[model samples]
Target chain A: MAAMTHTETDGKQGLLPAIPAGLRAAAPVTILLVLGFLAPLLTVAAYAFATPRSFDVFRSFTLANFSAIFDPSNTVWMSFAWSLAYASATVVLLAAIAYPIAYGLNRMFGKWSGLVGVLFVFPLFVSENVRLYGWVLFFIKNGVLDGGLKWLGFSGGPEVLYTPGIILFGMIYVYLPFMLFPMSLGIAMIPRDLVDAARDLGASRFMIWREVELPLAMPGILIGMLLTFVLGAGAIAEAKILGGQSVIPIAQDIEVAFTYAQNWPLGSALALLLVAIVSGLALYVLSKLDLDRILGKR
Target chain B: MMKISRRNMMQMMGAAAFAGPLASATRAFAAREKELNILCWEGYNSAEVLDPFRSSQGARVKAESLTNDPTMINRLRAGETRIWDLINVNNPWARKVMAPAGLIKPLPRAEFEPYFDTMLPEFKAPYRWAMSDDGKDLLGMAQRFGPYSFVVNTDKISKATAEEQGWDLFNDASLAGKYGVQESDDWNVFNIFLVAGINPFKEHTEEEFKAFAETAEKIFKGAKMVGDMASLNQALVSGEIDLYMTGGTYSVSPARADGYPNLRAITPLKGPIDGKGGISWIEITSTVNNPELSPLAIEFLKYVQDPEVSHTVAFAEGTFNPVSQMGDPKCFELFTKEELEAIQWDTLEEDMARSAEYDILPDYDKALELMTAAKRLRG
Candidate 1:
């Protein structure tokens, strides 16, 4: 009952708590974000416009970058579409798998929520690469997954991580906690009377869940989902370590340009395109749910 | 009192900071036992010249295989000690970036002198760019050379006159859309210039770059896919691609071993683009800048070049035979005449003799720009 009240106790005080820093708070991070991610991007954008031999790097402007990006004969766009599809698949599958785990934690472990959360949180301690390597072992031909399935008479050899399925599993493993924590918090905070009221009114289990539990859990669900989607869309490491050339992602392609490919302006252009994609998503999520307001100080 | 004030003023102006800080960080490189580690590629683990030291010397060797450049650089940059005793790297990374980062140490002459002849001149060039101005400071050594050339799966192309027929394999009408080219190397982009018979260095205009791009656009017409050396090799073996462009067709022995009896190499008379082939500067550096391990590291360097070790690795790993053949006639018995040619960097040097040179490996900024552009183009 106390926790239920806590959920509705003003949308402020989560991430956007106000007291001292005010405008200067975001100033530091905003400046950092702009300088760190955007500054390089802006430089790249400038170069993308410059011709190969142009003297004035900043003022150079042309559409060759755009033309190069859109050369239909090339495989660039096809790869973008492929990554988008893969990321999308990752999100849908992750959400479905995570919701149950979130529910189990919220309902069964209210007495030990903090401890259980910590236990669930242990995977974060190791490096992302180590975790990806773990997935690699699990996915190899005679790895744990195949061996386990074979014992059960499933008879599958080439398992998930070696193929497209491995890439998806990596995405899910990384983002599952992103979904679970928030959804669990929301489920835990849902008013007990709501469930009881639906039962008393002779509502079916599906109806009670759909009309009652879901709409109220929407805030946590939306926040979790938005985060997971953004992470899925932005991931590069998981794909590179586990997917190889079999599953090329946009993030990996952007990385290869600066490192092995050594083309900065084009790397920048791809980066901007990625920003446009993620930002468009952020805006949509912001409009649909009063997330910032809910998250902001009351 | 007046003189004292003058002296004090002089001291203030000539403060200790005026004495330049250590040229780098104050950390010491002391000899420590069994504490450091190494990261490298699969070919880098050859046993003949290098691997014997691991057991006989009573030292622990933890070598990891990684081909991609970014991951290796990132791992080194992440500030972990006890990571590696050696990190073998390629140009222009060894010179342009990693050395500046102080992640590696300077190579000593004592360690380098014995194995010096085994290293070719191209092998010695990176040391200048990487270790010192003349590259004679001995900061690193070259283990293998991969020059740019083309390989054809004879099962696919079936050319009876390959050595004479040349690069028409790229534009052959029947092979259109059915062939493969490396998506790496901006130099390969200039291969289009070669097929069109243009010298890229003759005050090459944008027309040349575009002509190459257009040629590329045409060759790519109806193409099923594009990828790197690994992909091209896979395609050749799996019958997916008919022709492969690589650092060199030196893999002819192994390709032949794969039972493609008709496999052959065709380095064009006009030369393919600029030479992308050169040396890698993967020298082992110690955090302990000591007399013991330093000489031992050098000894290991010399010991590995002993023809026996080079022969063992060249056969096992399909990387080149790094030993100087004239120096060791006995090593000749280990490989066939054709196999010996397959491991020789001199063979490819003949092909690269007429071509212009572009340092595809440059400083970080240029490195990023070229690869980024290629990725953008590949995309």
Candidate 2:
């Protein structure tokens, strides 16, 4: 009788909460998620079938908007290619730069690593657009970079601003912090004893890093790559401020579609295509990674 | 009565107290008739033009700046006609697009037609292009207008050379990456047409389009930076670019006011299209379809025709240009000699003659697509 009573009490505690309690706990987040995300997505999908003549989705429906995407000469394809290229470049470049810095900071700085980490994140405090504008001053012809070069005895230098290379540099510069923080957190999470054990076993520094640190920091690498890729892929201001006419990516094309073309259906379709692409890629990535481990469920 | 709690009773009392004033405020807002909401280009939103009328009539004027006509027309088509009281668009859009679309109301002849007598001689009569196809309704009243072409740093490239070279200047490989292009697709499309020796104002043959594409592709390749007026001007002043393609007095004269007096606009003397070298844009101010705002719109029409207000419109902040109202002696007197020189007013008449008015392109969409493709190709 005592065992039965204890089992029943555990079931009551674990399986169910009071109706009001359950609602109160979930209501705010549920409401926020519905309003913030689902509504906009449904609206975008509805608009994808809407024609420009009427804002009401029910008034008109056409597949022309989707068909327009297949235009052989459409600049959107070029823009999409640029988006992928830029995002991939930024992700790989940032991973290379961020990994070393993160490892060094955690290993070398010891207890002072927090302050050093804060210094790395200092640029994030300033607005992204402001920082991009600052880069403009440095990158433009006869700008700070060129002036510095001239002062260093070069008469003139090649144009740096509004080039493909400068845009790549800007992507790395702006998103480096996002990559660094996650990687450092991952590095710090690796127990100190593991490193000491590797050292006692006479493992080379490079060998220890390759075998021990790299595997341990996989979660951080995944997180860093995901954040950096998504942020850089959807970048508009950096492209506008630094890329100029030299770089016209899909974000700019979507902007032009809405603002200049006044074709909401077309713009919506284009936007949906972009969302599909990014989501597909993200899902593929998540499939490869052990997200449960990253979330601490494992 | 309903056995309200203390909190509920306080809320009810508060609501009762606020409802009276709120109702009165709503009534007062609807009753205020002396209001005008205008959508116009950059130069027309100046307080110097709007303040006098606002103070004189005890009215409020809300003005918004627009970069192009299609954007404003698109807004109206999207049900913004009820919000905007008056609109200013280029002549072709007012006639061919807005009027036909019923986005704008026909102007009352007695109220608006007389202003043309005081305007430039070209506007003195009912120009067919400014009227509906059947020629019955007058669509809009004309005001601020000028020949829009290219601007160059006169110290770097002399006006004589710029005028003489015409569209050929852009074709020169020596000037490659030395000029900046603004990303006004319509304007650039027309410019490419001019460069390709075809008149964009008329129907274009496929061969002509091919030529235009070639020219546009080449022009895009030659440009170092493509941006708006601000960026182009910065590049010009910073010695990054010597020429600003598709610029006009509207872009250069403002910089003159800011001490960059070396910047000057040039309208070429001849081009492939019947020897016409540049395009003149005339802005037409029209009342929206809102019947309630018609009276206020009429008052504004008369107000803008006043020479002082016209002068303010010409020298509106961010840009300065010669207004058609300058034909009036009163308006002409407001411009200083230096200001006239800054706007290249001495050569204005000659430039005007050399230029043809901008017209509606039958295949504007196709042109936009071509230009866009060319831009991408350049990228």
Candidate 1 ranges with C-alpha deviation above 4 Å: A1-209, A216-224, A235-250, A261-298, B1-28, B32-42, B45-51, B54-143, B159-165, B190-192, B200-203, B219-222, B247-266, B269-297, B312-327, B335-379
Model 2 chain B lDDT-worst window of ten: B290-299
Candidate 2, residue B98: Cα displacement in angstroms equals: 0.8
Candidate 1 lDDT, A1-298, residue by residue in tens: 6466678654555556664557756798878877898676677667666653232347667766557777765456655776777667876887788777787787776678778778778898998878876765565545677667878899765634424566777788887788888878667767889899999999999998899888777778877887887888878666555653345577766766555554545666677777788879878977898664345332
TM-score of each: 0.55, 0.85
Residue pairs whose backbone atoms clash in candidate 2: none
Residue-level lDDT tens digits of model 2 in B88-171: 988788778888888888887766667777777777757655677778888887877778888889889998999999988888
Give Cα-based local distance difference scores for all models: 0.57, 0.81
Candidate 1 local distance difference test against the native:
0.57
Off by over 4 Å in 2: A1-40, A51-57, A73-75, A103-134, A191-203, A288-298, B1-36, B43-62, B125-138, B291-309
TM-score of 2: 0.85
- A23 Cα displacement, candidate 1 (Å): 25
